[model samples]
Target: MLKKNLLAIALLLCISSVFGQEMRNCGTMEVDARLLTEDPGYALNQAQIEEFTQTYKSSETGATRTVITIPVVVHIVYNNASENISDAAVLSQIEILNEDFRKLNSDAGSVPALFSGVAADVEIEFCLASVDPDGNPTTGITRTSTSKTSFSTTDLMKYNTYGHAAWDRDSYLNMWSCDLSSGLLGYAQFPGGPAATDGVVIDYNYFGGPAYAASPFNLGRSATHEVGHWLNLRHIWGDASCGTDYVSDTPTHNTANYGCPNYPHYSTCSGSPVEMTMNYMDYTDDACMYMFSDGQKDRMQALFAPGGSRESLLSSEGCGGGVAPTCDVPGSTSTTGITETEATLNWGSVAGSVGYNVRGRQVGTATWTEGYTTGTSINFTGLIADTDYEWQVQTDCGGGDLSAYISSILFTTSGGAATCTDIQEPNSSTGTAGTISTGVTYNALIANSSDVDFYKFTTTSPNTKIRVTMTSLPADYDMQLLNQKGKKKGTSQNGGTSDESIVWNVNSSGTRYVYVYGYGGAYDVADCYELIVEVSNSSWRTDGSELLVERVLDNAIVNIFPNPASNTMQVNYFSVQETEITLNVYDLLGNQVQTLHSQVVQGENLIKVDVNTMAAGLYIVEISNGKSSYTEKFMVE
Candidate 1:
């Protein structure tokens, strides 16, 4: 079903007219005029023209070299059935936009001889938005799935759904691409009139179709025409009968004419002369059109003036000209911090950028230590812990001037030091022998022979996610998350021979339990194990939000007797709880698992919980109160 639509048909004579006939009026004309030039077309009277001229001349005299940047967000509304255009295609279109707007179209040489003389070098550039309206870095393109391929004036609302995902509009230009219902390939709504629909829409066939389709003479020209609308330029043929396109030089045409026509064609208007077939707003094939009259430039620049829609883009405050803090990484934030065991630097690159330099120093030091020609992100190791240090990054833009230095903001290294203040219990069993912070508990077991070990834990939250990493693995072995009574979660190969971890995402909430067992066979001597417990942070209540920290099961000593016990059970603690202890349980679905206990204690203690009345199933024993927690996988068989 992939086939060409009417956009590629032979030129037909179907009464070419303004797509928005009813919507055309003086208000629209005035807005378009105000965008390309300071003077509105309605104000062409001696008074308005003279005033605009004076202001413009004075502004020109004091103007400094400036480049106005507009962020862009592209929304690709496709059927989502075909090969989804890759992200690379989205970026390619952005590149084409920048190249075309700056008059750097790769096909400039291909312009027909009849139009070469009028080819206009529009002085502008575009960039993908570095910051979305929500203030996040985005490549600036979105995609939506739909069954319908053809869009019309009413379909314009789709651009909003596509663009609303952007962080902001005043800061970003939204462009939507889809199949159109008519001969129209693309159209821009121009900014201001309505916030509900404030963006441009282009037909997909005219967007990035191969080279010919991509030519400024083709797909490329659509962007030019739409941007003109974006910048407030009226069509050269105007909107109605003798509707002034506003530029005095463009010979008036009664309606849109297709293909190229010889000069000297007569018009009904007074001074009737040849038509301006080279104007971008004409319906002729892209190769037949060119130029934005000086009058048009005036109108375009007017939009960035005091009363224009894009005036905010012209302010000195809006310009970000300070040196970019250099980094070993291109997209990373630069800041001062402790000398890292591994230090990395990054920054943006221009074509031909050769190498980079890294400089660093201990905190408070006057001189910086330098490193030679390096690429992005350099790692430094063997540094003293608990010390402060700063680093700066610089890039060599080929043989041109060197980029400004980017420095790291102030930061320190502390957690690595043995004497750090945040250090709570160096030993996992410090506070309680068999308890973690809350709703999680851990018990170790030593194998008599060389076999796998089984463990259990519970949670209090409706659902749970249990991940286990070996605090310290036995010599050579492995483990897995096995099928329990509730549900099977996930399993992962441990980092080493005897270590493993798993994460389970579930919809069910409340106390739930989970179980774990070794991979190979039964228990074996010298096979020591340590256990850590965890609960998912998907809870609605914020008070216990921190209860969801990642934990690795460690240690292998104690045991719970009467496997699948009926009532009371013995929890042998290798050590004693000096203060408080917390415990909870959970199901495999990761729901709360369940809360087994919450209380303070002092010394070696063996506590028993009734299970004879408990339903038969798999559960997790989560033990924690405030500071920390432990986890174990158990079952009530």
Candidate 2:
């Protein structure tokens, strides 16, 4: 029996060696030392580490499972196309991160028998940050569309388009995932280096792909391995010619050998037995690897030392707790005539809240009853009439701390005869031209209100159609929605026909605003217009058909499409005017592509850009109208 067992072990080792030898080139890979030595890279030195260690409480306990939680932010830089992965993909990666660190990888059980016994679960947890550096609520993900690809990972830290947002590095781990050059799976900025770029960058392929196209294994766990390096964990092969991973329990080898390897292996590094192929730090097929040694855990812990970039993250405030200086309150109100069952709630974000603890109490009632509050907002089922209620929210910061709470706010449900008014004047300085009312009141006097083009108010106890009548309009017009930044989000034209009076289906529990932009460049004579929005007991609400039109109107690009135009030609100008414009064409090899039109209108002016006179090869169309110029690529079809 003993002889059989030895033979079986020997056979398994041989198989492991073969498995570990499988090779696949990840493509012209080279680590930029200059870039990697930043905050999340080689930003920290021995002095910094020592200083941080002095402040570490671990010297007090010396426990391996120090129970440290790292906040993370995922930036997605992609073309506006499908490469801009869904929000679910980003969240899924976060879930996988927590699972891997906790030794909860679903494939751990499938790990080879020889390595299963050594699978070490690195005790750690990752979470999407709730508070930004300025302490505002965040989903921890930012998206940007850029014409440039193959962005250097280090440059990502400096450009806002990449992910630079003055974030608190110690409290947040920044990770950028994008389309990198083919073959390169991913690279990370190690901690304790020059103080520049911070975080990891992975080509989108390995980020969420099935795995084979990018290499190793499937299920897109490359982020797991790269993030390990991000936390200061070295590759399982010790990142040296001698593949000794330094961890006492791991075997020795003469360099990292990718692919599955046999157990109890032999190595050329001083005749030491084969190395541990299942280390999380090694570039192995995901299915064949599982484990993070205790030494790696120690290195990661060392990163959070006092002076390290991850130092501030160890604080209570950094962990998402303590008294919130901001409002952090959650409140809901309803529109009249609409059943009080549905209310729209808007509130400030509370710190440490995994979610929220929203509870409410009816008017004239002292006992506060618990209400729904899992996500940012919730829909209530049954509600009373002609009643006022107070609501409050508490932060669910992990750990045992729960004393954090926001003050309550009161809102009454309208029983009948609702009058919704704005606390401030309706803004009219900004909005889509011809889509808003630019009457007298929209002039210079309304300073703070300039950001708000309009305001809306609704009551729920009863539903109603708000008949907005202009009592003092020099001329009548419509309104448009404005985003938080005072940018036009939606627009509606009044057509300059009659003294405009528009009817809006306002929700009983929802209130919003639209700004007015006067057309014809003439300011209304009325000093202050009266908008007596009448509310009727009608169950009419705006179906989801409302469209949010976001147009780029800067005239920045003069795009001419169908260069080798046949019949219909389109010229896209950021700001096309009614004036005539000119277009010139040029050909390849330093020659003129073509000039289809000599004069075209300003806005979306389409000219034949006479491609009929051109050939069936490549060409460029340049459009210029004294004010701006744009070039576009087209071919004769």
Q: What would the TM-scores of all predictions be?
A: 0.40, 0.43
Local accuracy of candidate 1 as per-residue lDDT tens digits, 257-314? 5655565455665556567665666666566555555556555665566655666555
Q: List residue ranges in candidate 1 displaced over 4 A.
A: 1-65, 82-88, 106-120, 147-149, 155-167, 212-217, 263-268, 314-637
What is the TM-score of candidate 1?
0.40
Give the residue spans of candidate 2 off by over 4 A: 1-32, 35-66, 110-118, 161-166, 194-196, 209-217, 243-246, 262-265, 305-309, 316-637
For candidate 2, what is the lDDT? 0.50
Query: What tens-digit string does per-residue lDDT give for candidate 2 at 1-637?
Result: 0010000000001122243553322211133233211112121242244345334434622464467788887777785575577677777777877888888877777655655665656677888777665455678887777665555433443344333332446667777767765345666655654333556776666665352223454555677777886775555554444533324455554555566666655666665665666667766676666667555565667666555556667772433663444333333432223344344445555555666766766533335566545566544435554445555566454464443344445565534222233334433343322232222222211122123235443444335444443333333244565443555545543222122334444344344354654432223221334444455665222222223221122232233443335655555443435655566655433355445444444433334444555555444455555654433335454
The lDDT for every candidate, in the order shown, is 0.47, 0.50
Listed per candidate, the RMSD to the true structure in angstroms reads: 24.9, 23.3
lDDT score, candidate 1: 0.47
- Backbone clashes for every candidate come to 116, 61
